[model samples]
Target chain A: MTSLPALPTPKKLGLVIDLDVCVGCHACVVNCKEWNTGGYGAALSDQDPYGADVSGAWLNRIHTFEVVPQGGEIVGEAGEARIVHFPKSCLHCEDAPCVTVCPTGASYKRADDGIVLVDEDMCIGCGLCAWACPYGAREMDLAAGVMKKCTLCIDRIYNETIAEIDRQPACVRTCPANARHFGDLADPSSAVSIMVAERGGMDLMPEQGTRPVNKYLPPRARKPLASSTPLPKEDTTGATGFFAWLDDMLDRI
Target chain B: MHPAPSIIIFTTLSGLGYGLAVVLGLGLLDPATLATKIAHVLAIAMIGAGLMSSTLHLGNPQRAWRALSQWRSSWLSREGVMSIVTFVPLLWSAWVCVIESRYLALPGLAGSVLSLATVFCTAMIYTSLKSVQAWHTPLTPACYLLFAAAGGLVVASLFAFAGGGNASLLAVLAAVALMAAWIAKTAWRRNMLTLVPISTPETATGLGAIGKVRLFERPHVMENYLTHEMGFKIARKHAAKLWGIAVVLGGAVPVVALLVLAIVGQVSSAIAAMFACVALLSHIIGMLTERWLFFAEARHAVMNYYNG
Candidate 1:
C-alpha cells in the first residue's frame, strides 16, 4: 500500500495560489482548520489553550515574507518594500515521500484525484511519515493518536448532499481575495491549468523532487528600487470656479 | 530533532546488543564456559529492552504491530521484519550454546549474518530520510556498522578472556574497530557541518524571483506541532563540548583500555577483566552521548521554514 500507483492520476485535483492577491489575512488557514476538524478523521487538538504555551495541529498554514530586492533597503525607506503572503497545505505530490515512508500504510495518495490522505484507523503514530514530508503538511492529532492532513475537503468537494456552489474546498471558498483556485490540473482546459500557464506557476523546492501537484503563482514584478520618473503632478485643469478658488487657496497655503 | 531519551537508549543499547550477538554468533569463545552463556543471554536481553524502549516514544504503541506490514516500501517496516526474523536464528544459536553445550556452525553463522543485517536495516531508517539532510548518506550506515562491530569485539574479548580462549587477538581487534568507528564518525560530523543547504527561504516560498525573502510572520502565533517537533537546536559550544566527551569516553578510553589488557599479557584475569568491564561501560555511555548528539545536531528540512 505504500508503493505509488503504477499509473498517474488523470484528474490531479489541486490548488493554484495567486501570491499577488493574497492579503495575509489567514482566512483560508482558519477556515481550513474549522472545516477539517469536523469533516475529516480527527478533530485538530490544541494543547494549553489560552495558556502561555499554546500548540496544536493545523492542516493549512500561511507564512508572510518581506521581499527585498538586491541592493534595496529592507525597510520601506524608499517605498521598495514588498510583503508576500504564502499559504501552504498538502501538495498531494505524484511521488509523495510521506506515502512511501508510512510503515503502517496509514498515509496514502489516492490515484483518482491525487489527494494525499491518512487513514487514521491504521496509523501507529510512529511519525515517520511526518519526517519524510518536505512541506510540513501532515500533523499528528495527539488526542486521537493518528496523523492528520489536508484531504482537499474529501467530504465536501464531491459530496452530493451540499449545494453545487458550496461543494468546493472550504479554504478556497473562504478566501476573501479569491487568491485560491481549485480544479483538475491535468486538463489543459481547466481554469486552474489556464491560470497556471498564463502566470508561470512554480513549485516549492522543486529540487526536492516531490513534484507537488499544487502550484504557486509568484508575486508579480514590483517597481524598480529607485524609480527614474518623478511623481505625477495633480490635475488642476478640471477644477470648477469655486473648487479652483479652493485649490488655489490651498496651494498658496 | 529533539534528543528524546527513548530514541537515544534504543539506538545505543540495540547497537551494542546486536554487536555482541554478532560476535557470539561467530563462535569466538568456548560455548561450554559460563561466561559465554551469560554473554549470549545478555545480548538477547539488551536487544529486547532496546526494542521495547523504542515503542515508548510512539503515540499509539498498541497498534505498532501493524508497522510490519509495509516492508515493500518503508525502511521502518523493513527494520521491523528483519529484527523479528533475526530472532529465529539468534534463539536457535542461543539454544545450541546453552542447552546443547556446543557451537552449531550453521545457526551461529546465520544468526551473525542476520544480526548485522538487522543493524543495517536500523541505519537505513535514518539514512533514507532526505528531509533530514545530515542523516541521508552512505556514511550513516557505515558508522552504524563500524560501531556495532567495535562494540561487539570489545564485549566478545571479555568473554574470550573469561573462557580462557584467544583473548589477546580479540582485544587488539576491538581497538581497531573502535578506531574505525571513531574515524568514520569524524568524517560524518564534518560532512554535517559543511553541507550546503539546497533548499532555502528563496526556494521554499518561490518569492525569491523578486528578491530575498525574510519570514515576517508565522501562520500561528502559538507553537504548532511542526515547530515543536522539528525546531530543536543545540548551542554550538555545548555541541563541541559533547563531541569532545564522546571521543574521549567512546574512542580514546576504550581503545587504550583494550590495548592495555592485551599488553598486560593476561597476567591477572581478575584485574584485566575489571579493566574490560570499565571499558565496556565507558563505551556504552560514550556511544549514548554520540547517539544523543546525532539527534540534537540533525537539522530537518522543515526547519528551513521555521528558521531553526
Candidate 2:
C-alpha cells in the first residue's frame, strides 16, 4: 500500500513561494494551524500549554535566516546582507520518501490533484514517515496518536461550497504579504508556473531528489543607491580671522 | 533520532534470536541433541521477547496489526510480514528438533533462509531511510547480518558445550563473525564521519544564491514534534566514549572470549562453557550499546532547519 503510483497524475497541483517579499510574518503559520485544527485534521493538540516549555504539532513553520556572503566581507561599500523569511511546509514531492516508508498505508498521495495526505484512522504514529521526509514536514500528533501534516488544506481546496478563489490553502489565503501562490505547476500557462519560469524558482534540496512540486523564488538583487556630494572643508588656520569675519557678516545681516 | 530503548532491544535481541535460528537451520549443530533443543527454545524466547518489545515504542500498539498490510513497499511492513512467515517454519523446525527428535533438512533449511531474510528486512528498515545518511548504506545491512551471525555462533557454542558436543568449532565461527561485524561497523562509522551532507540550510530553503545562511530565530519558542524526534544531538566527547564502549564490549570482548574458549575448550569443557556464557552476556550488552549509538549518532536531514 505504501508503493508509489505507477503513473503520475497529469495535473501537478503545488505552490510557488516568493522569498523576495516575505516579511518573516507568522500569519501563514498561525492561519495554517487555525484552519487545519478544525478542518480535515482536527484538534492539533498542544501539551503543557502554559508550562515553561510549551510544545505542539504544527504543520507549517516560518524560519528567518541571515544569508552572509560566502567570500569575505565587501571592502569599501557595505555588501548586501540579505535576510530571508522561509516558510517550511510539505512540498508534496513526486517521489516522496515519506509515503513509501509508511508501514500502515496511512500516508498517500492523491492521483487526481497530487495532494499528499494521511489517513488518521490507520496511522499507528510510528514516526517513520517523519524520518523519511527530508523536509521535516510531518509532525506526530501525540494527543491523537497519529501523524498530522500540511494536507495543503485538502478539505478547503476541494470543497464546492467555498468561493472558488478562497478555496486554496489557509496559509496561501491568509498570507498578508502575498508571498504564497497556489496553482498547477505542471501547466506552463498557469500563473504559478509562469512565475517559476520568470523568476527562476528553485527546488529545495534538489540533491535529495524528491522532485518537489513546490518551488521557491529567490530574493532579487538590491539596487545600488546614488552617492551624495562631499561637505566643504573648514579653514582651521584662520579660525580667529574667520570668526571675526563671520561676526561682522552676521551684524551686517 | 532518540534511540528509544524499545527499538534498541527489539533489534538487538531479535537479531540475536534470528541469528541463532539461522545457525540452527543450517544443520551446523546436531538438531537431535538436547543441547540443540535448549538452543532452539532459547532462540524462540529471544525472538518472542524482541517482537514484544518492538511494540512498546509505538504510539498505538493496538493498531500494529495494520502495519502488516503494506509489505508492497514499506520495509517495516515487509519486516512484519516476513517475521510472521518466518515463524511458521522456525516453529516447525523447533518442534521437529525438540519434540520429534529429528532434524528435517527441508524445514530447517527453509527456516534458516527465512530467519536471515527477516534480519535483512529489519536492517532494511534503517537502510532505506534516505534522510538519515548514517543508516542509508550497503554497510548497514552487512553489519547487521554479521553481528547477528556472530551472536548466534556464541549462543550455539554455549549450547554445544552444555550438550557435551564439540564447542571449539562454534567458538571459532563466533570469533570470525565477531571480527567481521566489527570491521564492517568500523567502515560504516568511517563513512559517516566523512559524509558530506547532501542538504544544507541553503539548499533546504532554496536560498543558496543569497550567501551562507544561518538561522536568525526559531519559529516557536517551545519544542515541537520535529524538534523532539529529529533534533537529538550528542556531544563529540560523549559519542567518542560510547563508541569505545561499543567496540570493547560488543566486538573485542566477544572475539577474545570466543578465542579463549576455542583454545581452552579442548582442555576443560566446563571452563570453556563458562567463557562462552561470558561472551554471550557481554555481547548482548555491547550490541545494545551499539544499537543505541546507531540512533544517537544518525543525523536526520530535517535537522538542517534547526541549525543542527
Candidate 3:
C-alpha cells in the first residue's frame, strides 16, 4: 500500500505584548532589525546609513506620549509631569483590509492558521492595500518595490533544524523585559492565553473592527497617591529688607 | 486619495456624457433637430472614455474583467455593470431617435431612466467606501445624480434655446438644478467637516488602557510605504480656499447667472446653455478639489504608528 501523506501540522504563531512590563527600551526593535536583515526569513531593508544622517529599517518601534491632564482627578499641578511610551507593529489582523484590497492574490492569510503575509513574487508596487488598511500596519519595501511588514518571523519560528527553545521570533527572543510573548494563541493552556485571560487584552480600533489577532494587555494601574502637604503659592511681593525698605522710602519721598 | 488623473477625467467627463444623454431621452425637445442625436453621441463617448480611464487605475489590466463579478459587495463593480447597462438603452434610443424620430420617443424616455440610474451607481461607488468618511454619506450619491441631471439639463437647454424650443422653460430648469446643486454641495461639505475619524492610537494598538499614547519615535526614519501612502495631508488654510472656490464657482455663480438670464428672457436659452457648460466645469473642478481634500484630510489609523 502507498504511504499516506503526513497530515499537515497546523501552527498559528502570534505575539502578545504586555504594556505593563514594556519598558519601551526598543531592544526588541534593535534585535528585530538585526535578525530580519541577515536571516533567510523576512528581510527588512534600510536606505541611507552613517552619512549626514543614519537611519535603518526596523520592523517595530516604540513611541512615547505625554497626555496633558484634561479635566481629570489625575491632573498634575501646573508644570508637574507626563509621558507614555507605545510600541508600534502589525497586529496581523484576522479581517485584514490590506489582504482583501490587493489586486493580485499576493497578500493572503494562511487558511490553516490566521497569519497574514505578502507573497513577494506576486506583489506589484501598487499601494492599494496600504490605503485600504486603517491600522497602517503594512509597509512597502522600497528596494524591492513590493509591500513589506512584520511576518512574526515565519522562517525562524518554523525551522525543524533549529532547537525548539530557539524557534521563537527574534523580537520576542530579545525582549529583555519579557514584555513580549510568542505562542499558538489557539491553545487556551498556552502562557500567552493565560496572560490574556488574567489581564483583559483588547483589539486596537475595535470600532473599525478589523479584528486584529494580536492582543495588547493594558498597563496595570499605579498605587493611589499618598497624602502630602501642598506647597504654598509664590508671593509676587518684592525681596525683603533693603529692597523692601528702599521701595517704601521711595514711595514716601 | 491619490487623485489618479485618469480617474479624475473619468468621473468629471463622464458626468457630462450621462447628464446630457438623460435630457435627450426625456423628450424635452423637438425630434426634428439633429442636435439631440449629436448630444447623445457625445455623452455616450464621454461615458465610454470615463470607463476606459478607470481601467488605468488597476495594476493588472487583464484581470479588469473580474471586477464585474464583485457587485455583490463592491461598489466599483456595481458602477462598472451599471455604466455598461446605461449604454444599451442609450445606443438603441439614439439609433431610433435618428432613424425613426417620432416612433423612437418612447425608447428615449426609457433610456433617460437608465442614464439617471448609471449616475446614481457611480455616486454609490464613492459613498460606499466606509473608510473614506468624507465620501461615506448618502449625500455623495445624491450629489452625483443631481449634478449629472444638472449637466444634462444645461446641455439640453442649449440645444432648445438655439432652436427656439421654449427658452424660458430651459432657463427655469437650469436655475432649479443649479439651486439643488448648491444645496447638495453644502450638505456634502457639512458632512465632511463634521465627521471625526473614529480610530485612536490606543484602540489601534488593541490596548484598552486609559492613558494617553503618542509616537515618541517611529520604527524607522526613512519613508515607508505606509507613511508615504497614509501620510498624505493638506493644510487647513488650503482646504478653506478650495471649499470657498467650490461654493462660489460651482454653487453661486451658476445659480445667479442662470437666474439673471432666465428673468431677462432675451437670448435666455443660449445664456442658460452657456451657464450650464460653465456650471458643469465649475462643479467638476470643485468636486475634484473636494474629493482630493477628502483623501488628504483622512487620518489613517496606521499614521498613529508615526504619530502623524
Q: Model 1 over residues B1-308: C-alpha lDDT tens digits?
A: 87889988988888988998898888887888888888889889989999999999788999999999999999899989988998988899888888887998888898899989989989999999888899999999999999999998888888777763688998999999999999999999999999998788888888778888788888888777787677778999999999999999999998999998898877677777778889988998899999999988998887767666
Candidate ranking (DockQ, best to worst): 1, 2, 3
Candidate numbers sorted by TM-score from highest down: 1, 2, 3
Best of the two (1, 2) by DockQ: 1
Q: Model 2, stretches more than 4 Å misplaced?
A: A72-79, A224-253, B266-268
Top candidate on TM-score is 1
For A166-232, candidate 1 gives per-residue lDDT tens digits of 8899999999999999899999999999999999999998878899999999888876746658887
lDDT of 3 at A101: 52
**In candidate 2, what are the lDDT values of residues B1-308, reduced to their tens digit?**
88888999999999999999988888777877888898889889999999999998787889999999999899999999999999998899899989987888887899889989999999999999989988999999999999989888888888887763568888888889999999999999999999999888888887777678888788888778888888888998999999999899998998898887777656666667777788889888889989988999999988888888
Question: DockQ of candidate 2?
Answer: 0.76
User: Which stretch of 10 consecutive residues in model 3 chain A shows the poorest summed lDDT?
Assistant: A1-10
TM-score of 1: 0.95
Better of 1 and 2 by TM-score: 1
Lowest lDDT 10-residue stretch of candidate 1 chain B: B157-166
DockQ of 3: 0.19
Q: Tell me how much of the true interface, by contacts, candidate 1 captures.
A: 0.89
